[model samples]
Target: MIESISKASAVSGTKATESFSSLFEAPAATLEGTGATALNGETFMSALGNVAMQAANNLKRGEEVSFDGLTGKANTREVVDAVMQAEQSLQTAIAFRDKIVNAYLEITKMQI
Candidate 1:
């Protein structure tokens, strides 16, 4: 999967770079006192939700493709690719969940 992703980025070249930069481009606004920029609550939550949904969709697609392969609808390569991608996504989601849980625990241990 990493090889495929690298090949894809290589194929896209400058277009991929432009898209990546544009996607993460900073907003213009800054906080009143801190002068630091941050995503507003709604925007942050929406982005997080979108990521979660995408992962879920990927996992579902992988399952569907596996079933299709069993039914002779999808080929071996397609099923393998989908399954690998889904596994990667699941690992990422698990890592994120672990980080969040650890952060919460740390916060609880902090002195107010």
Candidate 2:
């Protein structure tokens, strides 16, 4: 029973991540009239913004799942999955941010 539950969660977690990532497939679409070059610079910021939004959404979903689990409206397995996914998303965002900061520091350290 435990193994089956874990397997189910693993599958669902993958699906959820895929759906979230799919949201960023076309960041430039909303700016229909702008030249593609303008969008090129915006794309990095847009992707970062999207990732931050996803992390927030995942954390919110985790809270909802936890509440549901507490009230007996959701399965424990689901709560575990939601919380785990949220934690992973948060960690990834933080790491990405740290990498960006490090890059900025390195650039600033250059004599140029």
Candidate 3:
């Protein structure tokens, strides 16, 4: 029974990761008028903005779901999913920040 439960949980986790990934795939219709029809057409600044917005939204969702869970309005699975997504977003943002800081330091060390 325990093995079956663990397997089921693993499958669900895989599905959640897939769904999360799909959220970042902008539909062609939405990109049509923005001049970013292709993935490469997106500018760095716009991509950064989109990532920031997504992170903010994920954290917000986690908070909301947590509150709902406390009030008995949300199920455990939903709360867990939201929190996991928010944590992933935060870690990604932190990683981005670290890379930017390292790049700045590297630039500072370069000779004029």
Of 2 and 3, the candidate ahead on TM-score is 3
Write the residue-wise lDDT of candidate 1 on 20-107 in tens digits. Answer: 4455445555344558666553444346556666777788889899999999999999999999999998898789879878987998
Q: Candidate 2 on 1-112: residue-level lDDT in tens? A: 2233234334434767567546544445554555444445454545666677677778878989999999999999999999999889879978997998898799889996
Clashes of each: 0, 0, 0
lDDT minimum window of 10 residues, candidate 2? 1-10
Full-model lDDT for every candidate? 0.71, 0.71, 0.75
Candidate of highest lDDT: 3
Error of 3 at 38 (Å): 7.5
Better of 1 and 2 by TM-score: 1
State the number of backbone clashes in model 3. 0
How displaced is residue 109 in candidate 2, in Å? 0.3
TM for every model, in the order presented, reads 0.66, 0.62, 0.64
User: In model 1, which range of ten residues has the least summed lDDT?
Assistant: 1-10
Structure candidate 3, residue pairs in collision = none
Shift of residue 84 alpha carbon in model 3, Å = 0.6
